[model samples]
Target: MTEPSTKATPTTAERIRSAFARAGGAMLAVEGLEPAESPVHHLLDDGSFAITVPVDGAVAQLVVSAGQAGVQAVLEMTDYAPLPLREPVRSLVWVRGRLRDVPASEVSALLDLIAAEDPNPALLQVNSGNGDTDRDTRYALLRLEIDSVVVADSTGAESVGLSALLGARPDPFSAMESCWLQHMESAHREVVDRLASRLPVSLRRGRVRPLGLDRYGVQLRVEGDDGDHDVRLPFARPVDDISGLSQAIRVLMGCPFLNGLRARRL
Candidate 1:
């Protein structure tokens, strides 16, 4: 199979959703509040997120002070390449919205809903403390009502509506992208070298590294003396499973008979 020149790429909404799905943490900036880092957050279907913060921390206090009107906030998540590269950041996703506290009466129900969607252990910390514990160590739940989302990458920045983001699903390969990229960089140097040959002469001159993978294609980062450049190598077609991914990589490497490649368990 030959690689397509004009390869398919993910839609803006899909890209945003995929980035959100993969990010393990976010930097939250709220109006009248100091910027904070939150490692525990769950993206809901409504484009909002349930985040856990210190009960007596600045963010929780702001949520209480801001009241029902909510506070203007932007949660930024950076998508980093799985492999080492000159430019490690692959993309940035900004979730701009209003922040408010979940009512004490409703917090339990909301936590249940979030846990059902994403069962992260950190969620349990919200209720781990008792009145005797330090308030600063106790966690509380807050919600961010997303108004708009913008994803910035090498390609450019694109704004996605809250509704559009809610409708789009993350790439099927998202959960496995990091593992696959790391595998390519460590275990398949020759394959990567062969794939680099497919690039234009100018790009082939640089040190090519695997940057990302999705149902659409594989992204490569070329580090030359000047700077880092990103390029996408679309598969013959989109793939959904390990078998299809292997076939696609083989096609990109121009070695149909390459063997003994063990499939990774997702």
Candidate 2:
């Protein structure tokens, strides 16, 4: 039987990439404009992204003022865990770049691409062509040319190059992690307890809760009076599918039988 490693598999780049893919909202700060809440932002392949702001909003106004030179901008995005674990924010991504207005002619094509990529409802509010032509035109799109990407999490802070971030992919299990972790917390408290048992005696004193999940393994948050600590319990191997995930988790729980039987059942 393969034993699980204590080491984490998701590197800084992977974590940042995954967090960017999962983030629904971001706080954007432009050189001349006040910091604005950008709930409608989409990450592109090259680490640039489209952010929608009110056409008359400060960001749009700044873009019009800055012209082709572009304005310096920094976008901050937080990655929250699926479970309501203490310190639920698993990671924060800060992207510093140059912000420029997407030309009027390209808005249609850009909107189409963003909608195809994420299909976020916020995009619907901006796409006036979707039977909402009569609705007031409120939003304008701006693009950010990423200069650097930084990620801060329990592991630590690291600056990832745009190339490295763009090269990395979100964890294969990231999409389903929420459902799986929610189920583990709500329906399988006993399983959490079993996993907690693997923690060091010192860490076991704190309240152990599911923090994050990835193809590499599960992360646990130990919350106590001292503070919160994150521990990664890696799988025997990286898992790509639900069945593989189940087997990896079972191995982490240290059940003798690895064949379909769950550790909890044993």
Candidate number with greatest lDDT: 1
Each candidate: what lDDT?
0.80, 0.78
Per-residue lDDT tens digits of candidate 2, residues 1-266? 11235665987888887887788788888765678878777878756878877766788788868899988889899999877766688888988989998877787888888889778777766644345642465566889998888888766689988788778888887766677777788888877888898888888898989888888888888887888878778887788887888878888888736453232321
Q: What is the lDDT of residue 82 in candidate 2?
A: 79
Q: How close is each model in CA RMSD to the real structure?
A: 3.1, 4.3
Per-residue lDDT of model 1, residues 203-254, tens digit only? 7777889888888778788898877878788988888887887888888888
What clash count goes with each model? Answer: 0, 0
Error of 1 at 226 (Å): 1.3
